[model samples]
Target: MRLLVMLTCLLAGCLAEKPHPCESPPLLTGALTVSTQNEKLWTYTRFMYDALGQRIRLMELGTYENKSFSHDVLALFREATMYEISYHNRTCKKKPLKTDFQPLAIPKDATLLGQAVLGSSSGPGQGLLVNTWTGDLPGKAGKYMNTVTEFGCIPIATSYQTSEFGWAVTSFFNNVIGIEDPGLLNPPDFCPDAEMMDSKVEPIDFLSLFHGKA
Candidate 1:
């Protein structure tokens, strides 16, 4: 177990198997384009600010194939983006510690994506409606086609100083590209690492994240 943790500290720019799942919901506040061999989907989850590093509003639009799915404003997260996350070390089982949110940064295509919802519909009450009929169909309802939809889609610990922990994190953060591993079939070590070195986000400039909040 100790050996496993040591390996993670030594390796970066790739994935490593983390024992634990995401302890908290992802702090999503930007645009995400998810594509597979079958189809492509673009999602724009609108985000508003509560404070410097906190979020207040929430809204989203997902487009799969040609149909569109708009999401309702459900909940808000305060300082999750800025708060440090400490849980079971996913890469190494023996290590127990907390890591801060990689200071949010601006996405590369910030200007094009963050500007508006692309390929989206402007329909009213455009979100989903949950209507289940056991034996009868509701009065004011129309039939719809298509039920199945295609999918998606992090990182990781980063210490301020290398000496802060057993391993040093000269830089710790993730980019929106290539952040998934399927298990032993595809270990984190095999997956590529986070991209914050050539990134434009500063360690403390949280609002700048509003640009690449994905």
Candidate 2:
């Protein structure tokens, strides 16, 4: 009985540490559009990056009922910092970012779903299904997972799910054409709290925006 218990313990440890399939790190940097099933515009995010996989800029653009909204964040890895600016449609509350900076990396619990053709970009990319812990999926205790699709080692799409709503690709973007917009990496003069840069931003409401349209 003791031997049996020891063997079971060893097997459980092995399963707990499942080996990840060999995959190149994602170099996602460019404009990405995320939406729902009915082609409703959820988020239009533009990204810029340096030689490393560091995200330099993340610009989110959206239009709801004939109203346009824009919010963005600037990431300065070398400075170990990032700045978030919110274009409050309802209120102009420019809350500062509060999370500390850490090097970007893939989720450790992510499992490779497989390779498939995605978007108009050439070449095949792998999908990472991450088991995330957010109070979104029903009975999931806020712990749910989603698949992240990447192209050419760059993330092109993913479906974000939450318990407040059903599973869907809340945010994703295609046609990630390269650009040289230096100004995008800089916070505007109106954003006086650049020194208080951090790594947090407001979450986009993907389902609420697509009310009747979906």
Top model number, TM-score:
2
Off by over 4 Å in 2: 1-28, 36-41, 49-56, 64-68, 75-94, 99-105, 118-152, 168-179, 193-214
lDDT scores of the candidates, listed in order: 0.28, 0.45
lDDT of 1 at 174: 28
Every model's Cα RMSD, please?
25.1, 11.0
Candidate 1 per-residue lDDT, tens place, 60-127, comes to 45555557765422111332223211123332111111223332332222221111222343775453
Model 1 TM-score, all chains together = 0.20
Number of backbone collisions per candidate, in order?
A: 13, 10
Query: What is the C-alpha local distance difference test score of candidate 2?
Result: 0.45
lDDT of 1 at 51: 27
